[model samples]
Target: MAEGGIVRVRHCGAAIFCRRAPARCPACGSPLRGAGLPAAPVRLPGPFRHGHRQPRALLLRPAAGTFLGGYDGRSDLHVGVSSSQGVVYNYDEEGVHRAETGWEQCISIPLVQPDMFGLLQQWDKLLEEFSAGEDWLPHRYDEHDHNCYTYALAFVNSVLTAQGKQQMSKSEFTERFVIPRTKQASRYLTLHQELTAKDFYIVPLPDGENQG
Candidate 1:
């Protein structure tokens, strides 16, 4: 596993690789590493990471799994709740199948921290938007992208309402999750974007937001 519990896809030559396994290269019977090939700034995810957005921009990230959901304090203030429609149900056969009967799920994860501040920022350079300077210093970068998919927020009110702790209100809900007016220069720098936040969060996830 990685230093943290972050597990991501790796590429070796023309093949994709994974760090933990039983997983083998589809082309060869070898283990994988996230750093298997080249690591480029363009390879890095997020323009926000490139100093794009104004600071105080809090982002949200969602936590998603195949069959279950749980709380993760290791993440930002927001918690995300999501469900997937299995690819097995789609008849087009265009989706890649991990197994014969199992369908790949496209899960929607939300982040309530700020721009480029969650797991989705860990995007493939060939697959994602580019940012400069992440490579100019040669410091090791967090593989996790400052994005929403991995840094999803579950919303303080969303969880409470679902758990019967906080009553649901349209006004209260909207006020809590929408974008805020604050520091406009330092949002979405790395993992745990919430840690640097000094203001109240307007997390969008229903069960998202609470300072630890």
Candidate 2:
């Protein structure tokens, strides 16, 4: 898989998108390996979904009505953690809630490998306890500072602490893990917007750019 949580496979001399690095391209059944990162955005199959059946993942999605689906980094987002059973634990104005729906609308960053059985066991329990804690009371939900992002980071730090690892601040985690994926998504959205508007979008390059 390439960086930014996307797998780019060369198919018919063009790149196609997948989240996992499959042995064969999902679109054409061709062997997929060492295709390298894509130079342009390609349409993914269906909507951009993640977190379903992905255990110990940090889930992210644009909040309702966000322009360009919040991949532009200028809008608010809803965040959550996924459990072994694909349930999402998140906080909002209504406080902590375990959700069985909405994973199909998210993009995920895996926080732990699935083979870590001991840690996976602890993850669900810790998530439950953290969600029920008093710091996440509905009355305390602050849109700008103490909302979903805060709650998600706190839970991630709790997991780090449990594993005797250094805990991460919100900015650290976001920069190190989240922003890359969002930037990839933003590129796709920008291309999609251009295609929707004009049916074709050409890259604007300086003189002699990429002329080999």
Per-residue CA lDDT of candidate 1, range 1-212, in tens?
Answer: 11122122333333122222324444445553443332111121222121112112222222233111222424333212221211111111122111222212212223224453332343222111222223211232223433222222212233344345755454454365443311111132222233233211122222332111
lDDT of 2 by residue, 54-146 (tens): 778888877664333334556667888888788988899998888887666566788888677888778888888889899999999999889
RMSD of 1: 23.1
The best candidate by TM-score is 2
The residue pairs that clash in candidate 2, if any, are none
TM-score of each: 0.17, 0.71
Candidate lDDT (C-alpha), each: 0.26, 0.69
**Stretches of candidate 2 above 4 Å error?**
1-47, 65-73, 204-212
Error of 1 at 159 (Å): 4.8
